[model samples]
Target: MSKTIFFVIAICWNISLIQAQFGFEFSDSIPVEIGNDQLKFPWSGGINHAQFSTIDYDFDGLNDLFIFDRSGNQIMLFKTIEENGDYTYKYIHNAASLFPEDLRYRVQLIDYNGDDKVDLFTYGIGGIKVYKNTGNLIDGLQWEVVKEVLKSEMPNGSFSNLFVSSVDIPALYDVDGDGDLDILTFNIGGQRIEYHKNTSVENYASTDSLIFKLENECWGKFIESDVSNSIDLNSNFGPCANNGLNIPEVTPRHSGSTVLAINLNNDNYLDLILGDVSHRNITALFNDTLHANPNAVMDSLDINFPSNTTPVDIPIFPANFYLDVNHDSIKDLIVTTNASGSSENKESVWYYKNNGTNEVPNFVFSEKGFLQNQMIENGKGALPVLVDLNNDGLKDLLIGTYFQYLDPADKISKIQCYLNTGTSSEPKFKFITDDWLSLSNSGYALRMHPTFGDLNNNAKQEMILGRADGLLSLYKKTGPGIQDYSLEEITLKDYMGEVIDVGQYASPQLFDITNNGRLDLVIGKKTAGLVYYENIGTKNQYSFKWVTDDLGAIDMGNIYQTDNYSTPHFVRHEDSLHLFVGNQIGNIHYFSNLDQDIIDDNPFVAASKNFANINTGGFSSPFVSQLTDDGRYHLFVGTDLGGLWAFVADKDSEPALKLTKQDTAEKQILVFPNPSKNGIINIKTPALKKLQLKVLNSLGQVIITKELNQPLNKIDLSTYRNGVYTLLFISDSGDFTSKKVIIK
Candidate 1:
C-alpha cells in the first residue's frame, strides 16, 4: 500500500477506538433473540385487511390478534404475549382452504350462536360465513356457511344481487314484545337491510327461525335462512340493486358506509349509527320497535353538508369510532371522510352532537374549524388524530395536510391542532396550527397520527408524524406550558434521495419488541415493508435497522422501493409488536415475534405477513389493535376495491385481504459539532429499537467493527475524517438498511 494510504488507514482505526470508549457500558448485555419465522396464512389468493382484538376469548386473559384476507378467502387468528418480557406471537388457527373465491369484506364477533362463546360472522361476496366457537380448541373450532341460512330468511327478490357491504346483528334482547334475539344486516348494494330474529333455544342450539316461531325466546342460536315478507328498512329505492342515477337518491344509497352499535337513546339497547357514504349523511336508527314491516318508522340523523362536500362522497369512508366530543356519556360520532368536499382545497369535518333518539335530530354536523383553504392534496384530507393534546379533558383534532403547490406563504406541510370546546350549551372550537410546520426539507404534508404515553415517562404526550418522504417525525411535549419540541426526524434511508414516501398509510407505534425498557418505533412502509428504529446512547438518539428480511430469513429488501403497495398499520401486543400491511393487489400481511439480530453486518428480525397464503390485489391498509372486541385485540383491514375485513386472532393465523402511504415529516436526529478531524460522532436515539450497535472506520476504505450491544454504543473518534465519514449500524431485520454517522 502507498504510504499516504497507510497513513489514512491508521488514522481511521484510532478514531474508531476513541468512539467505542465513549459509548455506554452494560452489565450483561445479551444479544436480542427474536422469532423470524413467518406465520401460516389460511387463505389461497391474497389478503386485503386484518384487525386485532385484546379481549380474552378463552377467558385466559391473554389478548389475541385477528387477520382477514379477502382475495385469498380466509381468516387467521394469533395469540399475543410477552415471553420473558419479550414479545412473541403464536399462531392458533388457520381456515383458508374452506372458503375459496368468497371475497370477504367485513367481520363481526358476537354470540350469534348464543353459546356464550364468541361466534364470528364474516360478510362479503359469497354472503356470510358463521364460525361457531366449539369449546374444542384442538378441533380448530367448527364453522358453517351461514349464507344459506341468511338466504332462507330474506324475502324473494328482496336482494336480487345478494351482494352486501356492512352487517350489524341485533343484541340478545328482543326488540318487540316477541321473545327473540333480533338481528339486522345492513345490505349496502342489496338496497334494503333484512332482519334475522334468532329463535334458538338453550342459548346454544336453535332449530326454528324467528319468522316461523315469532314468540321464541332463544332466537339467538338458530340460523335464519331467508327474509321472506321481511321489512325493508330503506324501501324508497324499490327492490332493485346496483349503483344507478335513476335511483331515488342521485348519490349512492349508503354505498361503502359503516355501521356502529351504540346506546343512541340510553335505552341500554344498542342502536345504530350508520355513516352514509353516498349521501354524505349520518343516519341514526332506533331499535325501539321490533315490528316486522317495510314501512317501520325508525329515526334517522341526516346532517346536510353544503352540497358537494368532499367528505360525504361515495366510497370515500371506511369505519370510524364514536367519541363523545362533549364528554357526555352519550357518545358522539367521529367520522373520517376522504375529503371535506370534492378532494380539493375545502376539506371539512362534521361534529354531530348526539340528540338522544331522533332520526333527523336537531344536532348540527358542522365543519371542523381549522386551517381551511389548506390544499387537500389529491382529495385526501390530513389523517386526523383525535386526542387530548394539552392534556385537556375534551378530545382535540390534529389534521395534517400534504403538498400545497398553491400555498407559497407556508410552504411546509402543516399539522393543524383543533381543541374541542363542546360543552353543555355552547360548543365553541379552537384551532392551533401555528408552530406545527415541517421540520425537514419543508416538503408537502402527508399523514400524521398520535403516539400516546411518554416513552421516558414524561408527563406530557408525544406525537409521531409520517411524511411523504418516508420520514418518522417525532415531537416531544416539553416544559411547564406543554411546549412542543421538534425532537428527531427519522428516515428510512441510507442515501439522501433513496427514501421515497408512499403517502398511503405508514402506521407507527412505540413498542418494547426487544424487551428493553425504552420504546422503539416500528414503522410499516406500505410497499416498502417494516423497519424498526432503536433508541440507544444517552439523550435517546434514534437509529433504525430493517428486520423484515432478517426475521423472515428472506431477501425482500428491494421490494420496499416498489410503488404498488398498501398502507401499513401497527399496534403493540404485550411485548410483541403486530404490523399489518396491504398491497395494491389486496394482500394483507401480519408480522409477529420481533427480536433483534446482527446478521451479516446488518440488524435483522422476523415477522409474518398476509396469512391464508392467498394473494389479494394490493392498495389496502389494515388497522389493528387489542381494542376491538371488548379488549380482545381484533385486526380490522379496509380495501380500496373490497369493503372492510374483521378477523378474530384465532389462537392462530387467518386469511388474506387485498389492499394499501408515505408522508414527509421534519428532521429530528442530528450529528452536530461537526468538522471533528477525529471521526467522533455523537449518536442519539429519541425513539426506540431492539439491538443498536456500531461499526468504526479502521480506515476510509478498510473499515473496522466495534460492537456495542447496550442501548448506547461508543466509538473511538481520534482518527481521520476532516471531510465526511460513515458510521453505520445494522438497523433492523428488514431488507432495507442504512448508515447515519456522516461526519464532516
Candidate 2:
C-alpha cells in the first residue's frame, strides 16, 4: 500500500480519470442477487441445459416432470399438486438428492425390476448403474445406488476411441424380441444403435438383481441415404429423414441424440421418438415389430415448439418426453429447449399438445417456460460494459454472456441490460431485456467486448465490438433512444484499408491516446498484448490508421487464459496517464506512461503488477463508474459465472469525492453520516467487559471484529465506502443486537 498508488479512476464512457485515495479502502458488496436468490435476475444461474422425463412420482395419478439439468448436475422434481379444484405441477425447485451425490446429466426413471415402482438408471464408462425404489418415499425422496445392470465388463476406451457407455443416450428396452428388457444406446460420435440384450434371466419381472450382454454393436443397418433423406446433416442439422423405414437414419448426424421407446401407434410394438442437440427437433419412428426393431418407418413429427423455438447446440445435450399432458387419449411432446433469442442456452421446459388421433398425432405449441417457477439464470458467464442507453444521468448495465470459445454458429452472444431504476448515487436495477442491440447471434462473437464512443462525433456513441476472432465491428446508433440500435457488421480496416485481425480474442477499447481530439482504439488480445489504432481522420469522418500492434510493450501471455482475460481500461491520474488492465487469472495490473509519448514506442513503467488486490475469481474485467449521486466512484468487475461485483472506496470528505476527470455517470450502498460527525461515529451500548464489536459489508461479509468493553466508543469509518453496513454487538451473556450503519 504505497502513497503513490493512491489514485482512483472516474469512467466517462470508455475514458477514465482517477487518483486512488487512502481515506477509503474499497471492499466488495452485493446489492443485487441473480435468479430468485434475492437480486431476482430474469433467470437462474447457468445456461439451464435441461433434460425432461415424465413419471407419477407423487402418486397423484397425474404425471410429474423429472427435469435433469445436465449442466447443474441435479435432478429436480415437478410434482402434480391439486389446488382449488384444479391441478398443476408443484413448481418447487426441490431437487431429488440422489445418494451417489451428483448424477451425470441424464437419468432414466422406469419400472426396471417390474415392481411398478419407478427406479433410476444412470450410465457411464462403467456401464448402466441401477437404483431400486424401496418405497414411495424411498430414502426420503433420495435415489441410492442398488446394483449394476450389466454382467459383462464394458471395454474401457483406448487411446484411439471412446467406450460405448461413456457417450450419449442409453435406454433399457426389449429390442432383442426376448421377454427380458435389453439396453439400447445411440450417440453422436458413434451414430449407431448399440444393443445389449438382457441375458441374466428369462424375464426382467420383479427381479431385484439384473445383468445383460452386448448383442449387436450396431443394431440397425447403416444406410447412406440421399442428401434429402438425412437425419442430422441438414443445413440446420435437423432430422428430415426422407428415407423409408427402419434403417439407422441418424448415422450422419454430428450432434448427440436422445431416444425414448413407447407404443405410439398402439400397434402392439414399441415405437421410438428421437431428439437431437443441433437443430433440436423431435422425430418419430414407428416400429415394424421386427427383431431389434430394425425396420422402423420415419414419419417426421409435427412438433410445434414454443414461439417456433427449438433449442439447438447445447453444450452437453437436449431431450424430449411423451406424456398425456391434458389427460387426452393421445400423448403429447414435451421438450427442454433453449429458444432462439438474443441470448444463448437459456433453457426452459415446453410442451406440444397432441391435437390429433392416437394413431396419427398432431402436436401444437403450448408454452416456452412450461411450469417453471424460479427463472434466475442469466447465462454461463457475464461481462459487464456500463452504458446509459436511456440518456439518463445514471449509468445503465450492459452485460455480455456466453463465454464458451466454440464456433460462432454454435455460440450465442446474450446481451442483457439491467436498466437503472434509481438515481446514480443509490442505484436500483430492473432487467429490461437480454437482447440489447439485438447483437445475439449476429456475427457469432466469442467473449465479445463492447466499447461505446462518439467516434464520428455525431452526439451518439457508436458501439465497437471486439470478438474471439481478433476482429472489431461497429454497431452504429441510428435512433435517439438507447434501444434503437441495429447491427451493421463490417470489418474495421487500417489506413491502407487492410482488414485488421489480432489472431484471436480482440478486446478493443476506444479512447484518445495521442492527444488527438478524435477517439483512438487500443485493443487487448488473446496473446495478452495491447494493439493501438490511431484515428487519423477527423471527428465527422473517421479513418483509423495502424499505429502499433504492441502498445507500451504490454503482454500478459496465454497461460492466464484459463478464463477470459486481459481487458485494458485507461485512466488518467494527476498529470500522468495510467492503464489498469485485468487478466485471465482474476487480477488488475497497473502501469504509468507519465509525460511520455505513448505512440513513440516507449515502454510503460510498471506501477504494480497486482494492483488493489482486486480479484473476481476468473475472467475479471474491471470497470470504473461515476455512479455515486454525490460524485464518489465505484469499481465493478465481471466474473466467469455470470456475477457482477461492486467495490466502493471510503472517503474522508463530507462532499462526494471530486472526480479529477469524468466525462459521463453510474452508482453502491452504506451510511454513517446520519449517526456520525466527520469519520467518527459514537457507539452506545451497556457496559460489559466481554462485549464484542463486529462490522459487515453489504454482502454480509464480515469486515471488522473486535472486543468492545465500553458503553460508548468512537468508530472511524473514513476508511470505508459510503453504504449501508451491519454493526453487531454481542455481550458475554450471548445477547446480540445488530444495527444498520451508513458510512458517510
lDDT for each residue of candidate 1 in 1-744, tens digit (9 for 90 to 100)? 111111111122221122111111111111111132211221111222222122233345444444443223345454555566565444443233322234345555555444555556565444455544443332223344444324323332243323344432222234442443444444433334444444444343562332222222111111111222112343234322221112232223323444554544444444555443333444555553442321133433323321223333323332333433342334444444322222112233334555553432234454441112221111222333445556655445444433222221332345545455554122223544433543324442544434444555655666666655556555666653333555654544422234524345555655555555665655554444445555442224334444441222322223543543334454454444444455555555554433333223233232334343323233444544432223333343433312223343432111211111000110222343343434565544334543334443322232445543444444555453332344544334311112334333
lDDT of 2: 0.55
Distance from true location, Cα of 562 in model 1, Å = 7.3
lDDT of 2 by residue, 388-497 (tens): 77677767778876443233255566677777767655776666776776766577565678888887777887888888788888787888686887666567777687
Candidate that scores best on TM-score: 2
RMSD of 1: 22.4
Q: Best lDDT goes to which candidate?
A: 2
After TM-score superposition, the amount by which residue 463's alpha carbon in candidate 1 deviates from its true location, in angstroms, is 20
lDDT of 1: 0.38
State residue 443's C-alpha deviation in candidate 2, in Å.
6.4
- TM-score, per-candidate, Cα-based: 0.35, 0.50
What is the Å distance of residue 3 in model 1 from its true position? 76
